[model samples]
Target chain A: MAATKDPRPCSIADALALVGEKYSLLVLREVCLGNGRFDQLVRNIGAPRDILATRLRRLVDAGILTKRAYSERPQRFEYRPTQAGLELEPVLMTLMAWGDRHLRKDDDRPMVIEHVCGNELAPVVTCRACGDPVRHEDLAAHPQVSGWTVSGPSAA
Target chain B: MAATKDPRPCSIADALALVGEKYSLLVLREVCLGNGRFDQLVRNIGAPRDILATRLRRLVDAGILTKRAYSERPQRFEYRPTQAGLELEPVLMTLMAWGDRHLRKDDDRPMVIEHVCGNELAPVVTCRACGDPVRHEDLAAHPQVSGWTVSGPSAA
Candidate 1:
């Protein structure tokens, strides 16, 4: 077998390999927002038709989405998130909140989410075990891959 | 002026427009991991040299990273995250956590994080005001753009 080039395997890299294609997350955004039909996704996401179709197919194949026939006459289908895909919603929420804070002024934000708490949702990432906000400085990384360290591949 | 397309604005789309390019988030990952030198990023990220160079330049231009001169003779530089860039670490964390959960088995996971509370960090998105875990069924989205609704564009 060919020698493993990057022995430091990363799940982030793996996840991106699956959904990092252009407009993939946008498709998820549309679906999660209760617009799952092809036409709605095309209009809302504004991705080119062919590209949207491809991304949808890829997402479905990855099991992040399920396609079910919603129209009998024309066999039109709508996409729904699988359990795995629903778990990605927070990723979108945090990204949206970050963009809202950094990229746009309050009045110019294009969407607002309201949590069940009856307040405008401001998504924050927190550690599950301790309920502390996850910050770069407050965490340490351990490389689970053999021959690797947080700095880089461990010295051979 | 060219006709406006995608007039129903979205900050998520805007954010993705900036960082959603291929390998962009992975670039952020390496810098956040403190492996910001060009060669270290190239080796760790496994991106082609020219492409990685382009990505680094783009990230620098986008204000997510600052390039600082580190070596005098050869004029070597390293990348560091700016405030906006640091804010994006949570997105990376959530993505990594999702990949770990959905894509990798327990024994095969590549990295683990330890939070300041001394437990393995499991990142969860929660509502900032109420401190409850954010879930799909417990939130409502209100479109801020005029002539738009959660389902799509309202009848114009």
Candidate 2:
């Protein structure tokens, strides 16, 4: 079945719609790691072939990834992240950091280390206006409803 | 079926394994927004009741959320984010930002705006060392295999 257009313009919801599937982010991880071929993604992500294929198509349609033919006659293609896909690095990085910190008991460094600085990165989201780390306790959130920001709890 | 244990100590993969189900993140989003009650989350997220219950239990088991009795007698409880769960705000914020920038086309603001800044929050994952925004093209990623940082391409 095809995905339907969203009725509301919500960022978190939209983001989930893009990468909420079981293996979507894993597939993106493989592509980000320069493993672009279908077989390579399947091997790395451990997804069923058909599920991987469907995710690839959805990601391509979503503009997060692009497909390019690497070989002719036999028709082999490689998937590469677009500029949009590249921007999702923070999400992936933060998730990794969170997992390493909370979920796993890893003494070793986590996967995907940054080369710019030799330090293992711990991502913190800061407020752009006042330069404070955004925390749920400190901030009061207002959800937008009917073109106005309404004060209430919202996730969708 | 039970979720399989990951052999590797990769944080990102482990994190995904915890929350990669269809409605898990959505459920987390609900809790993050302070919608603690079951009916409230159900109303906001629109997941099946059974699925939402399962997601909630998984989240609690993963220590991302905690359940506390809010009402007496009948035994009603509310879910709240732990320190680890609160740390996931960055992931949720980045996903929201990504969705707004790439997925949706509404001229209005996309999601829950922090009351601290009147401006819409734009979360950027910056290097802890240099304070520059991390980008995929700028990052040279290395995968951790057998406790070694092997070089590869990364988004940030």
- Estimated TM-score for each candidate: 0.92, 0.86
Task: Look at candidate 2 and tell me the lDDT of residue A60.
Answer: 97
Predicted complex 2: DockQ: 0.49
Worst 10 residues of 1 chain A by lDDT: A147-156
DockQ, per-model, please? Answer: 0.59, 0.49
Error of 2 at B96 (Å): 0.4
List the RMSD of every prediction in angstroms: 4.0, 5.3
lDDT of 1 at B14: 83
- Give one digit per residue, the lDDT tens place, for model 1 in B56-120: 88888889999988788999988888889989999999999999889976657788888989999
Question: What local lDDT does model 2 show for residue B65?
Answer: 86
User: Which candidate has the top score in lDDT?
Assistant: 1
- Please report, as a residue range, the 10-residue window in candidate 1 chain B with the lowest summed lDDT: B147-156
lDDT string for model 1 (A10-34, tens) is 8888898898888899899888887
Query: How many clashing pairs in candidate 2?
Result: 2
lDDT of 2 by residue, A1-156 (tens): 322222334667778888888888877776776888887776667778999999999999989999988799899998988888888877888787788788766556557566466665667677667666777755665666543222343332
- iRMSD in angstroms, per model: 3.1, 4.0
